[model samples]
Target chain A: MAFTLDEAQRIVSIALNHGRDAGWNPLSAVVLDAGGHPIAFARSDGASPGRYAIAEAKAYGAIMLGMGGRAQMARAEAQAYFMGTVNGVFGGKVLPVPGGVLVRDLDGAVIGAVGVTGDSSDNDAEAACAGITAVGYTPEP
Target chain B: MAFTLDEAQRIVSIALNHGRDAGWNPLSAVVLDAGGHPIAFARSDGASPGRYAIAEAKAYGAIMLGMGGRAQMARAEAQAYFMGTVNGVFGGKVLPVPGGVLVRDLDGAVIGAVGVTGDSSDNDAEAACAGITAVGYTPEP
Candidate 1:
């Protein structure tokens, strides 16, 4: 199934609300289609100006690598030199941060990804996972 | 009203479809929020890799100047020195090209902007205008 715009907005709202309800700092979230293109994004009132770009880049990296940001981080750690070169090639679009999570449909296909920012890396990841779960999809974290 | 993600995606789809129905070249379209951050984007098959960046830059220029790209071009023509300075300040993010249009709510407040590329400049602007009108919004061109 296509990763519809409705689903992308739902994911962003759910992720941001989860962070807000937990009394976390204001967050920015981005949802990207499988092609590494943004589908939806939102930045809370107090989020830093740069959070929007960071969130989109994180989600782009996840969809590009077909894995969660944490998993991409692990790979980056194992191949630091290679990842650095890859990052340069992508003009720094690949951010191997912990906040990006892959969204998988019921058929086990990667449909898109969600990225959250404005909290600790682990907390960001949790918020993204929570959003995916809320939308009845699997979060490949 | 906020330019919702659903509206952004709808605009992109409608713009692309308009081009397709007219037998135009493959296109890339982008939707940006009021703050100039991308909300949605799509590049059709066979569209050049550069179209994405060009489309986004066009949209950004429109939103930044609070007018359509063609209008921005008029300003750029009338004040070449000033526009040159502005371009340098924005690090070339501002591109005064035809294909970018401002999206406005029913109340006539600027909500966001849409940019399309991969055809003649006037045709690109026409497609964007069509998309905004299809969604019952105003396209300032």
Candidate 2:
């Protein structure tokens, strides 16, 4: 299941549309390929200056660690050392604590991730989740 | 003097051409603004898989530390803490060990820097310096 750039762009566009309709201010939506590298992103006009980087970092963590925000926020779900090393591999780009959604194939193979920033962390997470679902992909529980 | 995006691209293109003329493999080159953030980058086909991150790191470090290749490599450098923190900040994305050329404006203001990777570290630094100089900017002494 190749993740086409078009598909990636769709994820951001739809996510941005949702943000607009949801009464959120400007937002940045990001899409990462299976390898957790950036494929596409959009930064709306009113988004915070920090939105772009944080969005990419959160998406990188979610996809690379193969977990959702809720699970990561759970008690002792992952070791700090391991998460730290993963962060190192991502070159300071992985924000493992959530606010992103990992998209998976029908058979449960991880394919991509979506991330949002600008709204509250919870809203950012929801927006990314919405993008994942909109693409007809199951997100991590 | 702020680094314009166009000048950054020119730095990368000149650096890359130097590598190409020397029969080096295709490489990745990056330039970062004064704030140690990426302004522009270019990766030729056949570049190393992780060259992008390396290039960014080098650019970031050079601009942040205000050092050139060999001098930036000094073991006794004072910014080691800042360098280490940068590692934590970017999760290994701020490799503060040189291989980049710091850029200065007419007033000697540190405007930006350029980095190249995908060859020997020496070659990478050399190419980056050559490129920055070609763009009519001073590389650190």
Candidate 3:
């Protein structure tokens, strides 16, 4: 389940479509490689430049933490001092947000991730999920 | 003597010239802020896709520690350990290398920094200093 440019593009499309359907104006979407590197990104024309950074950060956070936002929130109690030390480490490349998704392969291997922004957290997660599903990969149960 | 984009670009150009002059083809150069943030970057087009990450690391290392390459050389130092730990905690964003130069203004105040890569650490540091000096600033006392 290696993520390619085509799949990342499709993810952006689904996210944008979801945005349109939800009456959200526009957004910037980013897809990260399995190593949490950027694979592809696109903005709906009017999105601000900062959106690009935020989208990348959100997607990166999802992959690095290896869990969705709720799970990340749950684990915060286990690793004390994780938050303060983490920000200085990536030098500001990660964000703690509910907009990133892990893309897994048939064998449950994590291959890549998708992040969506410019809307509410729920809507952003929904758009990312749509894209993940569009690629025929299932998210973690 | 702030580390302007122009100075950053010039550092890359200097480092690139040194590489080409010495027959080190397809090198990369990058400049970063005092906080290990990116300012400018360049690659020889046909270089590896990982060039972005590598160049970024060189720049990050230079800016984060206040001294260039100190972390990479003294890997066992507590400072290096802290830097590496911070990077892992932040998801690989902090990089400590020896090619970063602290930028200063006429009043002898540290304002920003510049970093360069694509050649040996010696050349990387040389070019960074060249660029900083070209902007009418000294590298260090």
Candidate 4:
């Protein structure tokens, strides 16, 4: 089943709230549907305008690669040329960095992804995972 | 002053709510800052994947032209060559239609623009104006 708009907005809001509570920098969050189309997005008041694009890229990368951000990072290092070429195919929208977490349903199939930015990459990943779990889905961290 | 993320999200939500209340088709809405940067975006469940780009272009066109969608449309009709050239310069991101409304603050200064899609252009503009008014902002119709 597709993730509803309500679920997508919850993922964005919860991720931003988690970043705030953790005293991280202002954050931006984006939720993409299984088809890699954006369902919801929000940039915190003081976040830079570029944060939204970065956040959206993170989620797009994770969804397109069918792996979590960490795995993508590892692949980027091991197959730099291949990864770079694939990123080029997507018009430089694949950011192989932490903070992109895949959302899975009960059957462990990926349904979508949540991306968070505006903090340390590790912290961003933590917030993304928190949001995914809060929505009763497994976060492929 | 800049629009807070809360206000952007509210505009998106209110516009979608209006569309639903009026039994319009599934809708998509986007809000851009005065600098033409995206602040918030949402697409309803059944909207086509292309809806987001179209909605964003509508708002971007209005913000870039310093006028509402209707004005943009009028100019587009009167100056087809100029409008087409401008669209090419922006990588075809301008949609001269009735669904893009400019948001004005108390001083009659433009703050941002909202774009809505998925229904008829007139209906989309109606919802956009409703959302802007709900937030106590004037909508340049």
Pairs with backbone N, CA or C atoms under 3 Å apart (clashes), candidate 3:
A89-B86, A90-B90, A90-B93, B61-B95, B61-B96, B61-B97, B68-B98, B69-B97, B69-B98
Residue lDDT tens for model 4, A5-122? 9988988899999999988999899998887888889999889888877988899989888988889989988998888888898988888889988887888777999889999889
lDDT of 3 by residue, B50-107 (tens): 6557666655554554554544555626466777686676567545555655665667
Which order, best to worst by lDDT?
A: 4, 1, 2, 3
Tens digits of lDDT, candidate 1, B1-141:
666656777788899899999999977788888888776667676666467678888898888888898888898889988777876777777778799899877777888899999999899999999988988888886
DockQ of 4: 0.80
Clashing pairs in 1: none
Best by DockQ: 4
Model 2 / residue B42 / CA error / Å: 4.2
Interface root mean square deviation per prediction: 5.1, 5.6, 8.2, 0.9
List, residue by residue over A1-141, the lDDT tens digit for candidate 3.
567655766777778788888788676677777777655555564444366567777777667767664455445456636744664577666565567777777777789778788887667778888887877877541
Native-referenced Cα lDDT, model 1 = 0.81
The native-contact fraction of candidate 4 is 0.72
Q: Any residue pairs clashing in model 2, and if so which?
A: A91-B90, A92-B90, A92-B91
Which 10 successive residues of model 1 chain B have the least lDDT summed? B40-49
Ranking of models by DockQ: 4, 1, 2, 3
For TM-score, the strongest prediction is: 4
- For candidate 1, write residues A63-98 as lDDT tens digits: 777878888889888998876787787778878879
* Lowest lDDT block of 10, candidate 4 chain B: B101-110
Instruction: Please identify model 2 stretches exceeding 4 Å from their true place.
Output: A1-33, A37-52, A65-141, B42-49, B74-98
Candidate 4's displacement at residue B27, Å, is 1.5
